[model samples]
Target: MSEHKDNAVAETVLVSSSSQPSQKVRQTAPVSAWNVLVQGIALFSDGYNVQIMGYMQTVMAKLYPKQLTSSIKTRLSNSILVGEVIGMLLFGLCIDRFGRRVGIIATTAFLVLGIILSTAAHGNTVTGMFWMMIVSRGVAGVGAGGEYAVCTAQALESADSSASLQKRRGFLVTISTNLAIVSGFVGSSIVSLIVIAAYGNKASEGIWRVCFGIGIFLPLTIFFVRMSLLDSSQYQKHAIQRRVPYMLAIRRYWRPLLGCSLAWFLYDFVVYPFNLLAPTLVSGFTKNPTLLQSVGWSALINSFAIPGAIFGGWLTDRIGRRQTYAVGWAIVCVLGFLIGGLRFPLRHVFPLFVVLYGFFQSFLSVGPGDCNFLVSSESFPTPLRGHFLGFAAAVGKAGSAVGTTVLTIALNSFQNQTKGQQVLFFIGSSISVLGTLVVIFMIPNHPATLEEEDSKFREYLEENGYDTSEMGLVEKH
Candidate 1:
C-alpha cells in the first residue's frame, strides 16, 4: 500500500512507445463536455433572476403609482441586493464545509422560493405586493450572489492544470458571463411578449404578475436538474475530511480575500446601480409610458451587450486581466462622459447613446467577480478553496448591497427622475475608473499556477509563524 501510494504521487507524463528516446512529451486529461454544460446551466440561474428585475421595473412602477419616489423605488429594486449579500456569505461558507453541490442546489431552491412568493404577492393589495416583491427579489439576489462565486470556482478547478487550460479558463468562464447577458435579452423579450399579448393595444394591471410568475418555470427546471449535480471534483477531497473550518480558511487566505473583496467592491459599486436602473434610464430618455415597449427596447439593448461581454473575456485571455479590464474602464469613461453631457431627444443620437451604454456595460459584467475564480480557486490548496471563495463572494455581495442602497438614497433625495438617472450614471462611471486603476496597480499581473501557489503558501505560513506541515508539502524554515 505504501509503495502504491508513492508510485501514484511520483507518476509523471508517460511517453508513447513509438516515440524516440530523445523525444519528450506531455499527457493531459480530456475536458469534460458534460461538466461544462452542467456548469453553464447552473450559472444561468444567477443571471436569470437578476436580469428579470430589470424588465420588471416598469411593471413595478405602474403597480405602485404613488411610491415612485427615488428612495422608495430604489429601495424596492435593491431589496434583492441585500438578500444576495446574505446568500453569498452563507453559501460560500457552506460550500467549503458541506460541498459545492449543496451550495448550488440550495441557492437554486431560494430562486424557486422567490418566484413562488412573488407570484403569491400579486394577488394581494399594492403595498402587500410591493413587500412581496421586495422579499422575492431578495431571495433571488441571494441565489445570484452565491452562484457567481461557486460556479466560477467549480468550473475552473475541473479543467486540466496546465498552461493550455490556464489560457482557456478565461474563455470557459466567459461562456457563462456571455450567456447571462443574453438572458437579460431573453427575459426582456419574454416580458415584452407577455405584456403585449395579455393586454394587447392596452396595458393591463396583471401583466407584471404574469412576468414575475414566469420566473418560476426556470427555477423549477433547475431544481430537478440540480439534484443530479454531485459535488464538483475540486470539493470531493475537502468534503471527506470535514476538517476545514470557515474561520481557519479566512485567517489563512487573507491576502486573496482582501484583494478579491476590494476589487468586487469597486465593480459592484458600479454594476448594481447600472443593471437595476438601466430601464429606468431608458424611460427617462424616451418618455415611453408603455411597459411592453420599454421592456422590448431594454431587451434589444442587452442583446447588443452580450457580444461585448464575450469580447471582454477573450481580451482578458489574450492580453491579461489588468490590461483587459483597463480597456473596459476607458470605454466606460467615454460612454459616461457622453451620456452625462449629451441631451438627445429621440433623434438618432438617443438610440446611439443607448447602444453605447449597452456595449460598455458588458465590460462591467466581466469585472466584478468573473475571473476571481482563478484567484480564489488557485490561491488556496484543495483543502481550503471553497471557504475562501465563499468569503470573497460574501464580500462582493456586501459591495452590491452598498451600491444598491446608495442608488436608492440618490434617487429618493431628488424629486425628479431625470436628475436621479444622471446621478447614477456619473457615480457608476467615476467609481469604475478608480477601480480600474486599483486593478492595474494593486493586483498581480499574472495568476500563479498550483505548484507556485503551494510554495508561496509555505513561505507565507513561515512568515506568519504558522506550522503548515500537515498540508502534505515541505515548509520553509
Candidate 2:
C-alpha cells in the first residue's frame, strides 16, 4: 500500500511537470468589451425587473385593495424570488449539460413571455388580476434566476481564460455582475419619475403596467446579441466531452459549494428585505409620499451602492476575496446594531437615517454582495461550474424569499413598526456577524487564475489514483 501510494504521488508529479505548456494557450473564446457589455446588460434586466416590483408594490396594494391584503402583498413580492430559485436549479443543469447558449436563449424567452403576461394582466375581479400578476411575476423570476447563473458564469470564465486579465478578474467580474443592479435602480427611478410627472394623482392605476412593459426591451436586445456568442472555450475543452454527472460533481465539491452557497444565503437574507422594502420603509417615516418620492429615495439609496461595488471589486483584487468580505461585514455589523438600537432617536432626522442605512448597505455590495458570485464562479472547475453556481445562487434566492417573507411577517408581528424594523435590523446584523466568520474559516483563497486552480485539481485527482485520461482531460503536454 505504501509503495502504491509513493508510485501514485510520483506519477502525479511527472504528469504535472510533463504537461506544462511552453506558452499559455487561450483555452476559451476571445472575450471582447462587447461580450462583457452584452452580458452585463442582460444581467441588468434581472435587477430592473426585481427592483421595479418593490416600487410597484405600493401601488399594487392600493389598486387591488379588495384582494391584496398585507399577507397577499408579501406573497406577491416573494413569488418572483421563489420562481427564481426554481429557474436557477433547472437552468444550471441545462447550461452545464447542453451549453450556455441554450440556457441563455431559453431563459430570455421565459423572461420576455412573463413580462408580456404581467403587462397585460387584467380581470373583472381584483382576485383574478392579483393571481395573474403573481403567477406572471413568478415566471419572470425563473428567467431572472437563470440569468444570474449563466451571465455570471460566462463573464468570470471569459475573464479567467485570458492570462493578461487574470489579476483583474475579481474587479472585472464584480463590475459586470453588479453594474446591472445599479442600472436597474436608476432605470426604475427614472420610470417612476416619468409616470408620476405624467399622471400626477392618477399614477397608481397605470404606472406598474408601464414599468413591467419597459422590462421587455432589454431582454429582447440580449436575445439577439446572445445568438452571436460562442460557448466558453474552457467548457469546450474541458467539460464538453466528459460532462461530469451532477451528483458526482456535488459529491466531489460539496465543501466549496456549501461555503459559497451559505455565504450568499446570509448576504441575501440581510440585503434583499432591506432593499425590496426600502420604499415602504421610507414611506413609514414620511407621510403619504408620492410614487416618485418613494422610488426616488430608494433609487438615491441604491445610487450610493454603485461606488461601493466598484470599490469592492478593486479591493478584492488588492487584498483578496476573504479579507475584503471580513472588513465589509464588520462595518455592516456595527452599523446594523447601532441603527437598530437607536431607531427612535434617528427617526427625528429620517434623512440622516436613510444616509446611514444606505452607507451600510453600500458596504454589502463592496463585500459579500460582489464576492459571493466571484467566489462561486472561481472556486469550481468547468465541468461543474454551472451546477455549483446555479445551486449556490438558487440557495441565495431561497434566502431572498425567506428574508422577504419571514422577515416581513416578523416585522408585522410587533405592534410598533419601528420596533419591528429594529428587530429586523438586529437579525440582519447577527447574520452579518455569522457571515464574517464563515468568510474567514470556510472559503479557500482563490488562485491567481482559473488555469492554476484546474491544474491543482487535476494533480489532486492523479495523486488520489483517479485516471485523468479516463476523465477525458488532455494531458497538458
Candidate 3:
C-alpha cells in the first residue's frame, strides 16, 4: 500500500480473530483438532515402530547369539532410518506435487504393510530371518519417514488454516507431533518390557515377533481416519501442483533453510542414537543389568524428554521458536559437558547419572527435537511447505542414520562402555553448542499466523515474474 514499505513485510498480529473464542473455535477447532489427533497417532505409530527396532535388535542378539553380530544389529537398527530418509524425500516431493492427502494415505499404507511384514518376518536360517526383518522394517521406515513430511506439514497447515489455532500453533504442533514421538519411544520401551516379562524375560523367537506386531496397532486403527483427512485450507488456497518455482524458493529462503536443515540434522543426530541406546547407557552403570531392568530404566529416561517437550512447546509459543530452541540448546550444552566431565564420579551413582542423563535428553527435546519441526514448517510458505519440511526432515533423518551407526561404533570401540558413554556426552554437547549459535544467527523469528510468511512469499513470487495465479484455490481431483 505504501512505497516506503518496500521489502517483504508482515504486521505482527496478536489475535487475528474478531469474533468470540468459542464461536471461532467451534467453527475451526474440529478440522484442526482432527488433523492434530490423527497426525499425533501417525507420529505415535512412527515412533513406536521406529524405536522398537533397537529393542528388537537387543532381543534378537540374545535369542540368536550365533547369528546376530554387532554388524547385523547395527544394520537392523539403521535400516528404518535409511528407509525413513528415502520415504521423507520421496513423499515430501510427492505431497507438494500431488497433494497432502495422497501422501498421507500412501505413507500410512506403507507403515502398516511394513510393520505387518516385519512382524511376520521369517526365513530358513536365523540370519535370513534377521535380514527379512530388516528389509521389512525398512519398508515401514519409509512410511514412517513419509509421515514426518506428510503428517507434520498437514498438522502445521491445519493450525495455520484456523485463526483460533494460530496463537497456540507452536504448542499444538509440538505436543501433537513431538510429544507423541517421545511418548511412542516411551511406549515401545514399556511394551518391550511387558512383552519380554510375559515371555519369561528370555529373548526368543516369539518375543521379537510380538514386539514388531504391536507397532501395527496404532497405524491400523488410524488408516481410515487418515483417509478422512481433506487437504488443509492453506494447501487448498496455495497448492501449486503444476510447475513449482523451486529455484525461486531456494534463492529466497536458503539461509533459513540451511539453518532449519542443519538444526534438524544435529537434533536427529543426538536424539535417535541416544534415545535408542539409553538402555545400554543406563545398564552400563547399573548393578542389576537384566533385560527387563535395562529396558525399564530406558523407559524412564525416555519419559523425561516428554516434560522438556511439553515445556518447550509452551515456551515456544510464549517466547518464540528460535529463542526457546536456543535456550534449550544452551542448557543442554552445559549439562552435557558436565555429564561428560563427571562420568567417572557419576559411574558409581546411578541416580545422579540418570537425573543428569535424563535432563540432557529432555533439553534435547526442547531444542531441535520438538522445535525443529515447528521451525521447518512455520519458517516457510504453505504452498511449498511440504517440499521444504520434507527435505529438511529427510536431511535430519540422514543424520540420524549416520549418528546411530557412529554411536554404535563408538560404543564398540571403547573397551569400557562407560568411556563410550562419556564420549557421547562430549559429542552431543559439542553439537549442541554449535546449534545454539546457529539458532541465534540463521533461524528467523517468524510471526504467529497461518499466512504471514506465505503472503510474503506469494508477493515475492509475483514480483519476480512468477505466476502467483497458479497458487490459489487449487482443488484436487
Relative to the unseen true structure, what is the C-alpha lDDT of residue 344 in candidate 2, on a scale of 0 to 100?
Answer: 76
TM-score of each: 0.79, 0.89, 0.92
lDDT of 1 at 293: 66
Please name the candidate that would achieve the greatest lDDT relative to the true structure: 3
lDDT tens per residue, model 3, 1-477 = 232122111111111111212111222566667778788888987888888877777777677888888778778877888889889889988888777878877898888889889888889987898899889888998999999988898888767655567778898899888998989988999899999999988778888788888888888788888776666656656667778999999999999899999988888888888887787888766676778887888889989999999999999889989999999999999999999999988978989998999999899988778888899988888778888888899889888878877877887788987888889889889988888998999999876675667778888998999987767543223
Cα-based RMSD of the predictions, in order? Answer: 7.5, 6.3, 5.5
Q: lDDT rank, highest first?
A: 3, 2, 1
lDDT of 2: 0.77
Error of 3 at 91 (Å): 0.9
Pitting candidate 1 against candidate 2, the one with the higher lDDT is 2
Candidates arranged by TM-score, highest first: 3, 2, 1
Off by over 4 Å in 3: 1-27, 474-477
Writing each residue's lDDT as its tens digit, candidate 2 over 230-265 gives 555555444533434445456667888898999999
